[model samples]
Target: MTVILEATERRILQNPLENPEVLIRIVDDNQATCKSLQFFLEALGYEVRIWNDPELFLKEYKENEEDGCLLLDIRMPRISGLELHDILIKENFRLPIIFLTGHGDVEMAVDSVKKGAFNFLLKPSNEKKLTETIEAAVKLSIENHLKENNKTIYREVFDSLTPREKEVVRLVAQGKLNKVIAADLNITEKTVQQHRSVACHKLSVRNVAELVEFLKVLEG
Candidate 1:
């Protein structure tokens, strides 16, 4: 079946950042289904990875390090899609997952969603729906990946701050006056100002407000 996408979807695909080496991982034991889905997604300009064994998919998938969404089948040999989803969560795998279900597996699919799967597709899924779902999943994967990357970068920057600077900045963000910060840290007000200035420069923020906002992103 031919995949049909709206103009917005096409525009999103055109943006280079949206395409980031992100993968669409299919974990279905059915070889034919995996091959067909792989071909369809690749034709639409996505990198596809297929695993016929749920165990292998789990073993190979690297949490936080890999950028992708999972396309998991709800029913499989040895490990069902639901069971695999549980395993991933237990292992702290945060990749968005989309389950593929047959007609009789609706209940299980719904359960997967409740347990944090991105969404699900039915077997013989509509070409348009499948394309759209995969696109949405990939976009989410990229977003999550960038967010985690920022968290790492921000954490490193925060770590680079000296203990005095860290204390000063924390107080500054809490609306403490420089004099109060100096008294709290047992330093001169001028020294507090110096530490705050250095921290703002290291964090690339202009003032306490901006630094607070930057740290909020890290909190997420």
Candidate 2:
């Protein structure tokens, strides 16, 4: 199945200041199910945490200390999926949640969606469908991680430089733009131009914007 991310989902992923380590939590009452998802997701390069019981999962994740999305079974012992949803909010977990149910119901589905569940899936799901959904979630997690890391000193240095020498960022971000920035900074353009020539050589950026974006990732 194709994965669909609404504009809102895209924006969440695009934001640069989101949490890194958006962890994928899978909660079900079956060990086999948990293992199946965990293995598939780990193979797909996601960070996954799994639990075979709702009570235990809630116990472990008592606080909203986790990142990423949740894959929760709609039916479980101790607490039902809806109850768990309430618990998640009451505990202040802003993490997105996706529900899975062996017996899907319209009212239940509507309520869950209205309450911010990512998507609801039936049991015996297609691997492709699951994978696609996971891909969307993973993309959001990584993007947020990148954004958070980009807020560091490295990113500050990266953002502080002229838009041009950031092109020489390999050298300039490292303090190399002695001549190029001189012209840009109106000081001794030749100084960093020497540095720019070297910056261009080292950072391999044809220009500064690329250097800035690269620096953001490198800071990650």
Residue-level lDDT tens digits of model 1 in 178-210: 999888878899998899899888888887677
Q: Candidate 2, residues 86-169: lDDT per residue as tens digits?
A: 888877665668887786788888888898787888877888998777666656555554355444534554455566555445
lDDT score, candidate 2: 0.67
- Root-mean-square deviation (CA) per prediction: 6.8, 9.9
Task: Tell me the spans in candidate 1 whose CA falls farther than 4 Å from its real position.
Answer: 1-20, 63-65, 104-106
The TM-score, computed over Cα atoms with residue i paired to residue i, of candidate 1 is 0.84
The count of backbone overlaps in candidate 1 is 0
Q: Could you tell me every candidate's TM-score relative to the true structure?
A: 0.84, 0.55
